[model samples]
Target: MGYSPSIYKFVEGSDTPVPLDMDVVRAVLSPYDIGDPNLTVMDDGRLQCWVRAADGSEAEIFVDEVGILVERPHSGPGVFAIVAELASRLGAAVLDPSSGVFFCSREAHACLPVDMRKDVIVIEMTGEGVRAALIG
Candidate 1:
């Protein structure tokens, strides 16, 4: 899935509004809790995630505070494991379809004193999942 920074404007006042920049968002979001290392941290400090679509296409997300890389037209094994790892790390949950499209939310993750629950929208991938979704 492709992300535009403007998607966050809807939740301007939400507790976990989406990140304005893709890089900052990845730095903040959480991941799932399965095994097999769905998400991985590169030696360069970048995060990688994988998402498999129903049509046999896969989405790979590479995120960092400085850049965001979303690759499409690929697929492999352990797609769910990658998503689960991302959810666990971000204290979030994922709803994915075998067709390859998926949604991720971190509202249930660790909440701070001023945080509220809201469905932060993001695509599930094999690399680092999301940036952040806040409560408006």
Candidate 2:
């Protein structure tokens, strides 16, 4: 079987859908030291970034009103850790639809609610920004 893409959905607590602020996105990603940053606005309106991964691989990451998209994401454990860290920084949650795994920024895993049967996620855009939740 071909690889299934991993998706991260972002939402805000207040229910307002706001376009992701590129400045905040940049600040959140800066610590990763992604080399050769090339940012562009795609035809569909999403902001795309092409960067050099730590393992010397080329990676593409995109952001928009819906969420952040990672193309051909790394499957390493450190990648997940970085995801968790990013979730924490964004005050968001990361849900693995394929695996039904949920990572939260504000609380411990034990306290978060998850529905294993659901494969879709709904991101709530709050006044402060976004918070992720599982749906479908």
Best by TM-score: 2
lDDT (tens digit, per residue) of candidate 2 on 1-136:
1122333434433333235556767765555546434456779987766544355433466777646765554444333344444455555545455555644534322223344213333333231122123222
Q: Distance (Å) between predicted and true CA of 133, model 2? A: 16
Q: Evaluate model 2: give its TM-score.
A: 0.54
All candidates' TM-scores? 0.30, 0.54
Clashes of each: 36, 11
Number of colliding residue pairs in model 2: 11
TM-score, structure 1 vs. true: 0.30
